[model samples]
Target chain A: MSLGEFELIGRYFRSMELGNAGGSEHVTLGIGDDAALISMAPDKQLVVSTDTVVLGTHFPPDYIPANLAYRALAAAVSDLAAMGARPLSFTLALTLPEVDETWLQSFAQGLTDAARDHRISLIGGDTTRGPLNINVTVLGEVRPRNVVRRGDAQPGDLLCVGGPLGDGGGGLAVVLGESMPSSVSDAARDYLFQRFWRPLAQCELGLELAGVASAGLDVSDGLIADARHLAEASGVALHIRLADLPCSAALQAWPEAQRMEWMLGGGDDYVLLFTLPVASIRCLEVWASQGFDVTVIGEAVVGSGIWLDDGQELKEKVQPAGYQHFQRKSND
Target chain B: MSLGEFELIGRYFRSMELGNAGGSEHVTLGIGDDAALISMAPDKQLVVSTDTVVLGTHFPPDYIPANLAYRALAAAVSDLAAMGARPLSFTLALTLPEVDETWLQSFAQGLTDAARDHRISLIGGDTTRGPLNINVTVLGEVRPRNVVRRGDAQPGDLLCVGGPLGDGGGGLAVVLGESMPSSVSDAARDYLFQRFWRPLAQCELGLELAGVASAGLDVSDGLIADARHLAEASGVALHIRLADLPCSAALQAWPEAQRMEWMLGGGDDYVLLFTLPVASIRCLEVWASQGFDVTVIGEAVVGSGIWLDDGQELKEKVQPAGYQHFQRKSND
Candidate 1:
């Protein structure tokens, strides 16, 4: 019989352990048991989130297995970053049409690399036979009082982003051959592609913002939509200065309208959006000096919905619609 | 937009909390946030397991939504029982083809009931748009020293089962219209069907067996196959008595050959199969007296593989192949 689920896991996934960041010390028992045993840190509350990536729905079908694995892990772990939590471990439920040795090796390598970099261990998971689908449940921990929450945003708090926007969406558009800027440089195109294929979680910046920021969330479902999520949760309005959006050099090559669309509607950016008082400007300057792309985009106000403004005379009430699943076909 | 992923989750899944499972005491923050926060119990190691059920692979597409939800949760939580852990909380990643309110309501109701009965809170999960898939990551807790592992069996250990098996397979056969026994009563047929749709996790029994049993695992794939797994894990042989195999009244109504096949090869029973020392006979008696269907069906030996024996004189080596996904098309 071709490798059964158990044998496939044993061959490819069982030995992928965590290194650095306390190498598997948190795990009492790993795979090969009914369930993995995890030792939780005292004085820390466990933060848990799950995300599923369906083939053809989440990523392009032509993507390599390694890129797929990396993107999937990055997206899921990004939620922990939003919560300002330290990565602990994760479980993966993988369903595949068939077993491919080369694909498994590449995927495992990508997953192991990401897990190690994030200081998370592969505690336990399930492998089954079906249409390709990957569900990752990531576990992290943070001090109860220090956890950044979307509902904690306060009026007059400055809204900031840890990095640039629209790169992932631009990359996807270029990859799909639907929208391409004729004047875009080859380097810009390559950079955008890498942004989509392997986005950073901005976890360290999130940790830095834990006590400084009032509220935060990861920008996965586009800036406008995710900002609206924070606004609704915090029961406040977000007035965003469209001119202040930090767009990457690659994304800026697109037409103004196209660039705006990608900035507001792009998904998979995986950047942290947080709100903090003006007193945190010193912290922002420090981060900027340390080569982090931090930008103040707007401020929380005493109302609901989003208000968009330009540095010039242009001002408008923009509809907060982003890449919502079931409503949109793709991320952009 | 017809139900964005977030709205669907808020409408259908977010409210499905466990009332009896400490009423979210374990969850410091449930749902809504970027990630859920869970408070871990002290002096206990957490047990985590993930299982994904895909449409047209794990179950029949025509099955009711409620039954599907119940079976999925039961199967995932059964792993915790095998590990002798108390159910704490679970996260579900559900991907559906369309937004059907009736279907979501029914599924959520079934899932809620199961979670309440199992004492597991619905901490957090993800709802997305895609083909029908349900991935549940169950978290539980057990004392490290009392964990029932598959590798702890010893020679001369008495192998036992907590309850009868084969009803689920018979029920599945009936549901698929491949089996009809004239001698089976209506109640028998109903019992078999219920067994398949809502198998118990045997958590209470597993907890009781933790400190008393030498080794244990949930019987998911057929008895012969699961026994072989235990044997391999423990580096020993498991000798099972064919006549001693526990069969429910509903399953016994089938022909002798069919009954034997279902008992030995059927899957999804979710009963605990464990080994204990001969000195633990008193513990077995105590459990049996308290209405647990504990039965010593075999013994472990100082070798590998599984041996089947009939009370008379028949002895044979049984091939351990049962419910291997991709290898088998369906339960039958």
Candidate 2:
């Protein structure tokens, strides 16, 4: 209860083992120093991203520490994945209300699991006393030529998503104790919960799409909202077919209207959404054959904004809608 | 009052100008994407540090947003100075309770001034809604051979400080409305306040000290406490001559006892504390001639803890004491 900052950091963070990647070769000096020193590969450029999650705003007040930790790190690392970068290291700036050893232990465990899964090293961090807030700054590397950007989508590019959508939103509904139809099975509920709590970064798929995909980003701000960003950035229009949007079996248990809303407007799926030329369809086949759940649910056109095409003959222009941190009361 | 996150970021952060350094050549992509891309020089290793300041904990709740922004960044960047790294870029993770355009404008102005002064570019950041917290992750680079470390001190190495100490604590007192003696002029009070609010990182001195100083760190954790860290890290003892410790003229106006306590135990004086070999004293003279206030204050010894000599036969071992975030009720 009366832990010093140094002791808390030493016990919970510094001594923790890194994931499968172990210590990074780039690390010259790590935790306990004024700054961490990292050596870089000569041919690689660094990719960096920062993400902050706050209690009550980013997650429910009573969320599990371990799950929150895992989700936070994974969500941050997903940026690197979106950019086709390999994980290198991350620093955590954690502000907590009090010194709770149990919470710290669980949080550390969750971080360890996430780090291992992501193959990144924990280089350094700052621990402070305040409201519960976690800021993760992830550093990664990619060859300059292999790096992907949002502003390179060609007009005729095929718009694709790495995997299923709507699961994260559905999972959030389950977490919030929203009433599920009596027909929704316990296994489906469990699946949705897992999707919400442990959304994996599509790193491998992103890497494969590096030179192949014209432009890409992770589906964090819902399929339609995020696609609009890519469209605007690349000066093209995105046409997404409602029938082609992939949904997990768990999410499919919901009504068609609810599933469509979650798929198009709900956020936090962490799957890669990208654009590739028609020639790269073979690559998609290769990926699909290799057990990747990549699906082409849209296309890039010469116009602007986003369009939704139902199975019917009608096509409607849709406004971008997703979780905007300041606009919304709370966010994922 | 109801600004979206993107609009807020675009208005305040993305459009800010860099200091005299202008935009960094290392930046390939900045601000708009999922991640910022930075190309690094092959021969130089990267150095990074993260620091967080929370409202009510790190500063008074009613603290000015601009001053807080400037102070937060300067303090964080001081770590790069401590490591003798050249400024490159930084990312800010900011959480606020509400969208106050007036507060944001002032804060952004402060950040702009600090960025320009430090010659670092803002690459990317995250804006979230929550209790006020600012987390800055700074990235810099240094050649492999020119790097300094805390665990490299040698016995008989002369201990030196970059400049005067205790002004920060004295200034904090001024900020907190502490009563000052009539003998302390308004000029002295102003000087103290500036020291607390705008402590410059001794970056030029730190860069010069690389390879010259056997070991070093910025004195943010008080003189005696920080010396203990250097001593322990290097497996040596540090002996300080009480008479030799430097105090700012403003701080000297206080009673000798209070001045000594602040000089010995006060935090947030971002001056470089380092150990130099006796053979390197000429370098110190060169630095002094160049207007650096470098001063020898002690020597590293063969023992294992910090010892204080009051210019007499009696030498007493001193316990390390400084602000620890978790242990203390509030911290700077």
The numbered model that scores best in DockQ is 2
Instruction: Give the residue spans of candidate 1 off by over 4 A.
Output: A1-6, A18-23, A310-332, B1-5, B18-23, B310-332
In candidate 2, position B77 carries an lDDT of 86
Question: Candidate 2: which stretches are off by over 4 Å?
Answer: A1-5, A17-23, A310-332, B1-5, B17-23, B311-332
Candidate 1 pairs with clashing backbones: none
**Lowest lDDT 10-mer window, candidate 2 chain B?**
B311-320
DockQ score of candidate 1?
0.54
For all predictions, the C-alpha RMSD in Å is 3.2, 3.0
Q: For candidate 1, lDDT tens digit of each residue in B236-304? A: 988888888888978777887777767776767889999999888799879978888988998998878
Q: How many residue pairs clash in each candidate?
A: 0, 2
Candidate 1 local Cα displacement, residue B102, angstroms: 1.7
Q: Model 2, residue A155: displacement in angstroms?
A: 0.4
